[model samples]
Target: MRYLLAGPDDYSLKQKLSEIKLSLGDTALLADATTLFEGARVKAAEFKLTVDALPFLTPCRLVIVTGLLSRFQPAGGQVNKASRLEEADTFSAAVRAAPPTTAIILIEPELNRRNPLFAGLADILEVHEFPVLDRSGLKAWIGSRVSLCGGAIAPGAINLLAQYVGADLWALSGEIEKLRLFAGSRPITEADVKTLVGYTGEASIFNLVDAVIECRLKPAVESLEALKAGGLPAGYALSMMSRQLRLIILYLDLKSRGEKEIEIRRRLGLTADFVWRKTAAQAARFSFSRAAVAYRRLLETDLAIKTGRMEESAAVDLLVAELASGAGLETRELS
Candidate 1:
């Protein structure tokens, strides 16, 4: 069996790979029969030899190659056109001639439709693309995941989970399992989700933003400490802070243009009413000039951490203090 598993939905792709691995019989025996090639740097001759080799002490073999198809993708500039075409043809022939007892799975995070290698094997490969889910799809997936884990969730809880986690299946799956174990015999409710998930990092972010915009130094420091304790990396926390400030600026700008609330929410892609309300309130409190200064400071802090001029933790602490102090607020008109 020849398969092409492509897409950015890594969790589902990995699940599919696991299913394939289990279908081959005993896990112990399959381990000996399985071969993995990680990168596109794998030579064609080496790949062919592995797939062509008979299974050792097993009925079948599994050959998994990741990023092999991406090497021939046109935008990468790794291989010239002529060389790509030749190598693609070579790989195509090898895939076609793979032994019936050998299951060859080619994996890529994404593949260009025009890639010669993908195009050549389109007819024979059992192609599966796992794109990120949309809103409705995410809701459905969350419900299904809960049920699959032997737990039921209320409709409101499903919506809340979808809003909190978005399309990151790995996080969604982990959250679902956590909720299932916590819910016991009863159905998971919106309150449970709120209590357990706590908006999946957004709650701390909101508190942090509120503290900084309100110039509440103690609260800002506490919120930053809570985020660090929750295992959010300093860089990610900084990015999220920047994102919130950007949203505040956007909300103010759109309101100034006389755009309606609904239109602004739609444009900003803020689907959750809770999130929309919070952002609107923050925008009301944070002037455009203040938000811009905070954003600029975040950028500088990011650069300082990346350049090793300041430690990530200390830099983030300083950024929170500087923003909370309203250091640059006097230079610009508050409005």
Candidate 2:
């Protein structure tokens, strides 16, 4: 059977690939019969030879090719169309000629539907596209993941998890497993997620933001250290901080206009009660002017890091110190 698995959702794509591998007889024999080819480097003739080769010590063989379809993408029309068509046709013909005993799986992180190769094989092969899930779909996936791990979770916990983790399935799956082990006999709750799920980054970001708002240099530095130890890159940390500051500014502005909590939450797209409450409290503590100053500093640090004016680590450290010490905020009134 010929199969085409393509999408940005690598977690699901990997799971689907594993399922296919497990379906072929014994694990050891399957490994022996499997052949992997890097589509970008592998020639069509070589791929054909491998697919046509008989299985070794197994009834069926699994042939996996990754990034094959994407290589045929026109790439803004820079590639010569005639040559691309020739190569794509060659691959398509190879795919069509695979034996019934061999399962040819072509995997791509993303594939252009208009690519000649995909257009040629779309009708014959089993094509699966794994798009990133929306909020509702993400909640369903989280619940299913928890149940699969032999654990139960409260609806509030599920909502909070979806909000904190968003659509990253790899992180979501890891968090669910951690929560499952932590909860043990009891169902996972909102508190558990608040304590564990966001600790890796989100919760720490909140803590850092709180420290910055309160002008507590010690806790802000500690939060920075925690984030660094968690293996989060400095750039990503800065981006998250910027995002939180923007949210706080928006919240304060909206609340000043007499917007109710429910309407404000909807406007901010904060669905989880835990997130909404935490953000509302932070907004209350942080004045709009303070958030604006911090956001400007964040932008400056980002520019410095991006323009090679300063190292990412040093730039982030300087930004944290400046924000925590009220260096720039001292000139402006608090409210």
Candidate 3:
């Protein structure tokens, strides 16, 4: 059987691939198109394919191709006998003629429905791009991973991990694994994560907020540069940093109403640890009005980004500088 699994959701596609490969037994031959193409100059001396190469793909033979037709060839154009594509056609034709025992699995392939490969394949599987998980997916995925590891991910810890990791499943899965080892007989706790998992930039974006909240210029600048260096998207940097500013503003508004940390946490649906840590940070640093000003600038940054009035990265840089500068720059031009 021939198969194609292609999309931006590489993590899930990879998981499905692992299962499929295990099902294909010992006789499978896995060959990547790029690898073979690169090796073809040397390989041509030993084994050359002709129209006769088609029958060689036997049952249980697994050949993997990635980015095969996307960047590699022209569709329905006149096939030049001299080109690498013609060579690919020869291999593909051979696979088509082979028995059902042969499996051609393409990984993250970029083939159009109109392409020749589409006509040749017996089966097609479409995989979707995994969106950033919202609150519900986070809880379920954490619960599942925790159960598999012989423990439970505490209810309170979910929000801490969610706030800290955002929705990057790649990063979250690894963190969950580490917690499993550290967990032993203990239930996962926010303190355990603080000590073990550490504050990823996802969590530490708040540090930059706290820095700006305190108006510590140097550290705020450093934090912004660190996020950019990590190749964080300009929109993402602004969003996360902006969220921290808003959190401060919200915490302050509630605090003035004589709301205690626990009450504030419950009202916001914040996990206990987040409310304690974040509220304490707010109390130590900001007044409501100052936080409001910072948040408005971040809101402006958000607008400029969405409206395309400023280029994405430049908008983030400008906002970071504005936030980092200790003096209130609201009276000055931001853009």
Candidate 4:
């Protein structure tokens, strides 16, 4: 059997891969019968050799290749075009001749249908494309996943979870498990979702960054406390804030260069449209000098936490206080 699983929904793709492995029977036997390769670097001859190898005390062998298909994708515009063409030819020939007892799985990002690699295999194997789910689909998926974990979620809580997490199943799946554990035997509530789901952390970290950048000292401290109360760890909160600052710095640089939002988003590899918009809005609030100072202070705080000079929780609070109060900035806007 040959399988091609391509998608942005990596969570679902991985789940499918796990299902395939589990279907192979005996977890202990998997190590023996399974072979893996980094497809981008692997030679077709080497892949064929593994695929031709007979199963060890099993009916079939499992082989997985990732990132290889991208080389053959038309829009990829991969370097070494001739090498990729030759590699695609090799793969096409080898896949057609693969042994019945070997199961080959190709995992790649979205590929063009016109690409010869996929067009050739379209009729020959099981090919599934997993795209990002829409809002309705995401909501249904969350409810189903909650039940799968032996927990029930209220509809209101479901809506709240969907609204906060968006359509990223990869993040939503993890958050669901956390909510399940936090809920225990009680039904999960909207309030519980707000408390335990990290949604508050996700939403408020941006506010905290804005408050700090704007020198709104009181709101910055309050935002940090609210995040901590919502079950976001000090280290996690600090890390998130640092990420926000870094994003702002990058956004400022890009805008200064007159780069458009779409180009900046592509450069940053940020798939979430709202995130890019939020970062842009935040970046607009700070001058380059202020953003750079905040970034430096963030690094100092991180180092202090690492060296054990300050506890993780206290370091985060102090970091917020200093940045909000403009301690490290020459401009030092006293609010």
Candidate 5:
């Protein structure tokens, strides 16, 4: 009854966790029998003691630990190298001796195969890894989820959802449910998706960047407003904008060197075809001077927010206004 779930796809991992929760049945009993430990902060001794405890009014106790493997595998200077090594050895030995009635679920975003935990429990633990999906895989997953919900979707609609949603399964899952209710017995269409999904934060950030590069005041401001309404944090949006600007700079450099699409993708480690194409096109649309200026402005805005000089929302509003006003006219007065 021991499980190891590792992956970057939190949505799928959460779904697996939900399935286990459902099988346990009584909500009240689950609260009593489950013990949760954050691997980084929790001590190794506490975890082992919890695993040895008996179930409370239930047949099995659920023990979950996250980030244990990564913490054991350090990146740089070993501040507590000996302590971490001891913890890893203790965790491995404790799990191996875990009671038959305990269900231990170990979760990590990335697990080191060389870790002692894996080396020792490799034979006994049930491991599930959820990797990020490709475009085709995402399309198929969306279609399957729609079918499971007793809903239908046009092929184009499926493509559009996958494109807009990107690879965040959690966001895609929520969107699928929303689209299902919106379609209401009708097969979901491209138009339906366009109207309902609009622009996800990731997609709209591109629009915002594109608008700034083109000096399209209205669209830039509108895109920023849409992102704000969608509850995307200002810092997160700024970081994404900064990343897009950097990509545009790199794309220009690679293109200047006669690197074609494939070479550029390989150099940038961009797996998604859509991402490469969109970035290349956006980079082409803006001059290097403009891109550099935008990057600098994003840094200033980021600093201002972090230093408490401006609220996150207000900083974003100012940023949009400034980007839109590059033509020496108020963005609000633009058509």
Candidate 6:
């Protein structure tokens, strides 16, 4: 039968894709559009996705078609607005005539619920877009997986990881396996989780923030080292910080407008914990004016790094110093 797995949660899509792979075992063939994205521009990548859910009815199978086909992969050449419109019309038609299969995969840029895809589906399992798994849902997902695998990741352990890992299921699951092997039959502990996975796994993007938040400048520097060693590019790392800070500013702005947290999410287009993280980051000790100052600093440094005036590693160092000053961590350092 045909399937339409469309949702705002990309991680959900990735997780489902992973599950499909697992269910099909080692023998099933998988094809996805992500590979083509690297070599082809948006308009030039000709993609019409169709897979016989049973490529051959003789054996149990899983045929997957990802949603990346509809997305842009950073076009290298000039505009072809005319060709794009034509492609959209063609793509829309293909979605209407989906084939039957034991399973079909859809993902990214969620299908419009009001659109025809939703109406045509035999079943639509509305997966909660879990960038952060709630307590109940966390137990359910982890519990079920444990039952399937004949072991548990433990509820307490799951929450501890969730505090840092959030809901990137793959990373959480990876850490779980690592912990499971380390613990064996013994119950997993937070210390064990930390000792094994450490902050590095869930820590890189946010380590500097935590360091800044807690006013630990030296740790921020060390975090810079860890992030770099972890193969996170300097510019991309700085960009993440910029995004966090700018989002904080946006959250604060909406909060000032008497917006409820949910309203802020709707207005800002932010997910739940993202909104919480921003509020938590900017709420205490730093006002909008202070955040604005820091925001401007990030903007300037981002440009300077892109233009080669400052390297991102050095920029992160400077930014941390400024944040330390902002949070009243060590004002004398900048002076």
lDDT by residue for model 2 (1-335), tens: 78899875677988998887887778788888889887767898898898888786798999998768767763342434786789888888887888888889998766677778888899998988886575689899999999999999999999878766656677688789999999998999999998996655876787678778878898788878878888998888899999989989898788666566678899999986546655765775565777887888899899999899999999999899989999868476433
lDDT of prediction 1:
0.81
RMSD to the native, candidate 4? 12.3
lDDT of 2 at 184: 99
Spell out the clash pairs found in candidate 4.
Answer: none
Candidate 3 lDDT (Cα, whole model)?
0.59
lDDT of 5 by residue, 1-335 (tens): 78899876667888998887777667578778898876767787888899988887887888888767756765431334465666677888999888987888998866667776577688988889876575689899999999999999999999878766656666677789999999999999999889988666767787677678767688678777767777887778888888988998887778656565578878888787556655765764565666667777788899999899999888988887787668442222312
The stretch of ten residues in a row with the least summed lDDT in candidate 6 is: 33-42
Please list the residue runs of candidate 5 whose C-alpha ends up more than 4 Å from where it truly belongs after superposition: 76-83, 200-240, 243-335
TM-scores for all candidates: the values are 0.62, 0.62, 0.46, 0.60, 0.62, 0.45
Return the number of clashes found in candidate 5: 0
C-alpha-based local distance difference test score of model 2 = 0.81
Candidate 3 wrong stretches, greater than 4 Å: 26-59, 72-95, 109-116, 119-135, 202-335
List model 4 lDDT by residue over 1-335, tens digit each: 78999866666888998988887777678778888776656887897788888897887888888766765653323334466667777887788788888888988767566666776677886888786575588889999999999999999999888766655565677788998999998877898887876455666786677678668898788778878877889889888988888888888788666565678888877787556655755665577778888788778899999999999998888888998888758565434
Instruction: Looking at model 1, report the run of 10 residues with the lowest lDDT sum.
Output: 71-80
Model 3: per-residue Cα lDDT over 263-314, one tens digit each:
7777766674643555444443565656677777888778887887989888
Q: What digit string (tens of lDDT, one per residue) describes model 6 on residues 37-90?
A: 211222222333423233443334343444333332112222335545455545
| TM-score of model 6 vs. true structure | 0.45
Backbone clashes in each candidate structure, one number apiece? 0, 0, 4, 0, 0, 1
Instruction: Tell me how far the alpha carbon of residue 124 in candidate 2 is from the true structure, in angstroms, after superposition.
Output: 1.4
For model 4, the superposed segments whose C-alpha errors exceed 4 Å read: 74-83, 198-335
